[model samples]
Target: MIAITEGPINTQAVIDAVQADGAGAINVFIGTVRNQTQAKPVIQLDFEAYDSMAVKKMQEIANQAAERWPIQKVAIVHRKGTLQIGEAAVVIAVSTPHRKASFEACEYIIDTLKQVVPIWKKEKFEDGDVWVAAHP
Candidate 1:
């Protein structure tokens, strides 16, 4: 499952989506909004995305991970729009028969998602705001 939403990402729901009977290890990655970037304080983050394209890219990433590893299921949920500090922006869950595969696949999904997903983030700062790469 892959989704680009305008609301908060439910980490538990993501995990539940990937639960499988034969999978023993379920790995999850939750990306949260941080309070600062490069020593500058941030007020909040506003995310925007080409929803359909972003979801397609996420599904592609999941497909690649599944092909590269022995994984049973994959779920990625990314939230857009305004978000406060410490709020979850993305949640990824992967289930596999072994722990190593689960960990590796989960890592690959998040890393690749940041690189290829068509999502943008605006850094709201005290001085001003700028739209930078969504993940940097």
Candidate 2:
């Protein structure tokens, strides 16, 4: 599952989506907005994405994970637009038959998502703001 949301991410909802009866292990990764960065106070953050491309890339990552691991389910949700500190920016939940595959696949999904997903973040600090690479 792949989605682009505009509000706070429901982590439990994501986990629930991926927890299937055959899945013995469920791994979840949540990316939250930090309040401080490099000694600056971050008020909030704004995220943007090429929805078509982002969703496609996320699907690719999920497909790759499915191919590599015996995963039962995969759910990836990314937030777009402004977010307050501590708000979840992204959520990834993967469940498999074993713990090892779940861990490895979960990490791979998030790492690859960061590398390839066309998502941008604007860190809104008290001092100023800066556009940087994907936030995790």
Candidate 3:
């Protein structure tokens, strides 16, 4: 499952999507909106994405991870639009035959998605708002 939605992300659903009888380990990574950044108070966050391109890039990341690891299944879900503190922005789940592969693949998926996906984030602060770079 690879998706971009405006609503809240269901982390359990993501984990469930990647579950398989052959898999022994499932790793999940959740990226959430925090209350502060660089010691600055955060009000909220607004996310925008070239939906089609973002999804394509995300799928590419998943495919690459599968090639690198013995991944049984993978799910990548990202949320767009305004999000309050503690709300999930992204959830990535990976299942593999072993724990090490699951961990490595999950980490690679999130890291690569952040680098390649065309998702823009605007952090709303108490003072103002600024568009942050994909890496930052």
For each candidate, the alpha-carbon lDDT, in order, equals 0.94, 0.92, 0.95
Model 3 TM-score, all chains together: 0.98
Candidate 2 C-alpha lDDT tens digits along 1-136: 6898887888999999997999899999998999888888889999999999999999999999999999999999999999998889999999999999999999999999999999998988766889986645
For candidate 2, the 10 contiguous residues with the lowest summed lDDT are 127-136
Rank ordering of all candidates by TM-score, starting from the highest? 3, 1, 2
Task: Estimate the Cα RMSD of every predicted model relative to the unseen true structure.
Answer: 1.1, 1.6, 0.7
Lowest lDDT sum, 10 consecutive residues, model 3, at: 127-136
User: What TM-scores do the predictions have?
Assistant: 0.96, 0.95, 0.98
Tens-digit per-residue lDDT, 1-136, candidate 1: 7999888887888899999999999999999999999999999999999999999999999999999999999999999999999999999999999999999999999999989899999999999998997666
lDDT, model 3: 0.95
Ranking 1 against 2 by TM-score, winner: 1
Show pairs that collide, candidate 1.
none
* Residue 132, candidate 1: C-alpha displacement in angstroms: 1.5
Report the number of clashing residue pairs per model: 0, 0, 0
Cα RMSD, model 2: 1.6
Local distance difference test, candidate 1? 0.94
